[model samples]
Target: MKTLQQSRAIIATAILGVIVSTYALYVEMAAESKPGYKALCDISEYASCSRVLTSEYSKGFGIIPKESALEVPNCIYGTLFYCFMIFLATFDHIGVNRLQLLLSLVSCASSVYLAYLLAFVLHDICLVCISTYFINGLLLWLVYNKNKQLVEKKK
Candidate 1:
């Protein structure tokens, strides 16, 4: 029964993550249609989405921005990362605690960084981005709680 509950929690988190990601992606794509934002192929510097996506902060080790390439919006990366959180939580629910712990930590850190970017750097907060951040926070909390419960059970 406890396992079932945990499984449901993980699944619910995943679904929420996917929903937030899709919405964020939609916003990113729509932003492209605006005059200031540019498609990834365009590299000009007048408030271009392409500029942000291609920037050093976009991804690690020269990997292209998956979210931008998908043409949704750069913010969709948070959505996708949250989706990964769900996957990790599910794996943890199925008895893989280490993966879950590592991923959740990553999610927590990413969420903080994203919030910082939205609030400080962008100086503009989109509804979808805010929603995704909230969801990520909730999922992180849940993952932490589950891990705590597991530790308690062991003791």
Candidate 2:
């Protein structure tokens, strides 16, 4: 019963993450294609989604060089991560739950780093970015609860 509820929560959170990541990807692409493109999330100069999405950190989390082959857009990574979370949550096995917890931990750490960059480095507010971070944090909480439930069940 609890497991089912947790699975549903994780799936729902991942779905929301997918939506926000997809929107960010669209904004990134549109900004690249169109000159002076402004996203709906672009509220002002400091709170501009377009500005953050097109910055140096937008691709490969500013880690990979632009000339590198692995330098894909960060939104693509987020989309794939959320999709995988949804799929993993479908399995109720202990191994699957452990994997989910591990992935969520990594995601949360990445979110913290990205949040710092957004606040300090970029000095810009991205609604889409913030939404995805919230979604990721929710997923981490859900996955952690699910893992706890599984351990309690085994005891």
Candidate 3:
């Protein structure tokens, strides 16, 4: 069984994720309107959220799936991903031992890759994106520890 604190942490992180991703999506959409517009997230040259967002990789795997036919903001995917995490946390076990841990690992892995792209490939940092990545990493850590606690309790 997960602890109350663990559950609360998960819920809080999910809520934060939703807020961040929604703002990111808003920035993305707002860009389509104004030509020279920049989001408040665009803090500086090295850490320009808007520039990183407009990069080719921002479309995410949709680039390969849609074959560039569609360009969906990565924020949409992040929002949905966090929503799923919240749902799972609220519903309890996913009928598979350590499923939540597995999911977190996958999500964190994706975040790591994206962070790499932002840092090394794109040569720019996105404040909003970095914050989301941090949240996901924290969520993964919390959930992983909770999974360990569950295993220990069973023994």
Best by TM-score: 2
Model 1 clash pairs? 28-73, 29-72
Candidate 3 lDDT over 23-113, as tens digits, reads 9888877776777787898778898887777777778642456555445788888899888878777644434326767877887888888
C-alpha lDDT of residue 68 in model 2: 96
lDDT of all predictions? 0.57, 0.94, 0.78
Question: Residue by residue across 83-104, what tens digits does model 2's lDDT show?
Answer: 9999999998999999999999
**Could you give the candidate ranking by TM-score, starting with the highest?**
2, 3, 1
Per-residue lDDT tens digits for candidate 1, residues 20-74, read 6665454455554664654433334433434444344434412355555453334
Clashing pairs in 3: none
Model 3 CA lDDT for position 59: 83
Q: Could you tell me every candidate's TM-score relative to the true structure?
A: 0.63, 0.97, 0.87
lDDT comparing candidate 3 with the true structure: 0.78
* CA deviation > 4 Å runs, candidate 1: 34-76, 92-95
Minimal lDDT window, size 10, model 1: 54-63
Tell me model 2's lDDT, rounded to 2 decimals.
0.94
Instruction: After superposing candidate 2 on the true structure, give the runs of residues whose Cα lies further than 4 Å from its correct spot.
Output: none
